[model samples]
Target chain A: MADPIHQFEIHNIVSLGSIGGHDIAFTNSALYMAIVVVGIAALLVGASSSRALVPGRMQSIAELSYEFVADTIQSTAGKEGMKFFPFVFTIFMFVLFANVIGIIPYTFTVTSHIIITAALALLVFLTVIVYGIYKNGLRFFGLFVPHGIPIYILPLIVFIEVLSFLSRPISHSVRLFANMLAGHITLKVFASFITLLGGFGIAGMAGATLPLALVVALFALELLVAFLQAYVFAILTCIYLNDAIHPGH
Target chain B: MATQAHTEHPGGKPQFPPFNKETFASQLIWLAVFFIALYVIIARLAIPRIGGIVEARRDRVEGDLAEANNLKEQSSAAMAAYEKSLADARGRAQALANETREKLNAEADKARRSLEAELNAKLAQAEQTIAGTKTAAMANVRSIAVDTASAIVERLTGAAPAASAVEGAVADALKR
Candidate 1:
């Protein structure tokens, strides 16, 4: 059976040489990221080109995605958070397109990498912290202090809250990274089982149908996960942004 | 898998590809580049266009609704005017009919009263004539009687009675 991990390996498309003692060559990962970005740009630009009062299919999709993210941000972060709309929209589309495109065979899963997800999560984290502090000053620390806690337990509660607040990025990034990594690895394993079983001849080929069916079911499930993880990432970003805008218990 | 990666790369690190530090900077650079590009595209191009479309549609619909409401109000006003005229015409017809009826009734009553007065006047004249005729006839009868009485008296005496005496005898006989 082929190594499932092999598919995740990055290959250089162009050798850009060392930058600050780090390898900065353009790789398949970068190529796929470029594809996702260009694809999104093209779709959006083309969809809006006609500007029909009554939307066509492509336009409908564009509008629906825009409204979906808009509503999510509006609900989670309130109107004040509309300032972060472009940031949030970019993150949502990036994650969504990366995840969905990764599902296609042989395409690099950009969000599957810990570095990528961590980068995205850290960006949101830093933005929240910077904006919260900038907008709210020291009051942003109120995020760690409950409004109606007993004085006796306020210290412990604040400690826990601080710890939880600090851990947001870890959980946020890991949730998406782990889900995609595991799902892809599992799909690859099950697909390998079909090949493994088929090598054993007629009975084995007949038995391979089970893993094949499992792969199909898992494939459908992974598609849902891809969409769900993107949504989860976007909503969580909104929630964190909400804390920045209105920090309280 | 770590050993396999180790063998595959021979002296390189055996870390999982996802956790590998080697490509982190490259990925970050590309991520920043593409994400900013996407943000620019969406913010500068897409959002404004979509928002404009929605705004335009809303304005159009609201304008159409307002126009419809205006037309409805005008129609209702016209209907009210039409109804008022219709009611006015109906009242005019009623008043006209009442006035004509009253005039006809008054004229008929005047005609009847005049006819009654004329018939009464003619009846009074006829009664007066009957009274006069009765008096004249009575006078004639009285005279005829006197003549007959006088004739009879003469035949019995073999001589004509005197005129004055005959009249007096006739009057006495009539009285008796």
Candidate 2:
């Protein structure tokens, strides 16, 4: 069988100048991210420029994505949190597009890497903390304090709350990265079976076709997971923003 | 599928890469830079455009509704004016009809009074003519009576009675 981890090797696409004795190199993943960002910008701008009273299909898709993020924010975080709608919407689209693009035959799955997902989760964590502190001043640290607890158990409750608070970035990043990595690994394994079994005979070739069929089926399922991961990420961000805005409730 | 594998390393020791904190920090810096760029685009460009579009749409809808309400009110006012004019015409027609009836009534009353006065004058004239005719007939009757009595007295005593004697006899007969 082929080495599964070999699929995750980062290929340097462009080498820029060194920054502080470290190579500031750009890779295929960075290129794809840039492409996703540009594609989204063009889609939104082109879809909405017409501003038709009756929308075309592309416009309808753009509007649906907007309304989806808007509604999710309103429901999860209330009207005051609607200001984050565009940010959340862009994040969802970028991740969803990147995951879908990776499913193509020769594309790299950027989101399968822990580094990418961890960076995204870290940004969300920092935003929540920084914005909360900026808005509420010193009172933001009170998020670790649970209200309505018995005075004697306050210390234990604070400890648990702090632990859970620290775990958000790990859980958020792992959920996306693990799902993508497992799905790609499975596809790679099944694809290897087709090559290995085909060398034997006619029956071996027929058996190889079975793994090929399974790979096809799993590919379809992975598409759904890609979209779901993006949605899950956006909703979690909204929930975290809510905690920042109103900590106790 | 569980075939035996040969390894260069005899012991089952896992091979791992060196953990460099500088590399991790460099990755973190790149991630932070990318995140800041994304944040700037979201805050400055995309969201404001979307909000402007929404606000413009809302203003257009409200303006349309306001215009429709104004037109409805104007139509109602025009209908009210039309109704008022119709009522004014009906009032004028009623007043004209009452005036025409009064004129006819006054003309009829004047004609009746004139006819009654003419008839009263005619009756008084006829009564005066009847009194004159009775007076003439009385004179004729008195002359005839005198002539017939004188002729009878002449046949018995050969002379006619005088006018004064005749008058005295007549007056005495009327007294009896």
RMSD to the true structure for each prediction, in A, is: 2.9, 6.0
Global local distance difference test of model 2: 0.75
Task: Calculate DockQ per candidate and list them.
Answer: 0.62, 0.08
What tens-digit string does per-residue lDDT give for candidate 2 at A64-92?
A: 77778888999998997887776787678
Off by over 4 Å in 2: A1-8, A16-24, A46-60, A82-86, A185-221, B1-34, B116-176
Please give, as one word, the docking class of candidate 2: incorrect
User: What are the clash counts of all predictions, listed in order?
Assistant: 0, 0
Q: List, residue by residue over B1-176, the lDDT tens digit for candidate 1.
A: 53345334535656577877777888888888888888898899878887777677789899999999999999999999999999999999999999999999999999999999999999999999999999899789778877777788878987888878888877787678
Error of 2 at B19 (Å): 12
lDDT of 1 by residue, A1-249 (tens): 778887777778898888889888888899988998888887777787888888889888888888899999999999998898888888888899999999988888999998899999999999999999999999999999888889999999999998998999999999999999989989998999999999999999999999999999999999999999999999999999999999975
Report the first chain's TM-score for all candidates. Answer: 0.98, 0.94
lDDT of candidate 2 at residue A35, scale 0 to 100 = 63
Please give the C-alpha DockQ score of model 1: 0.62
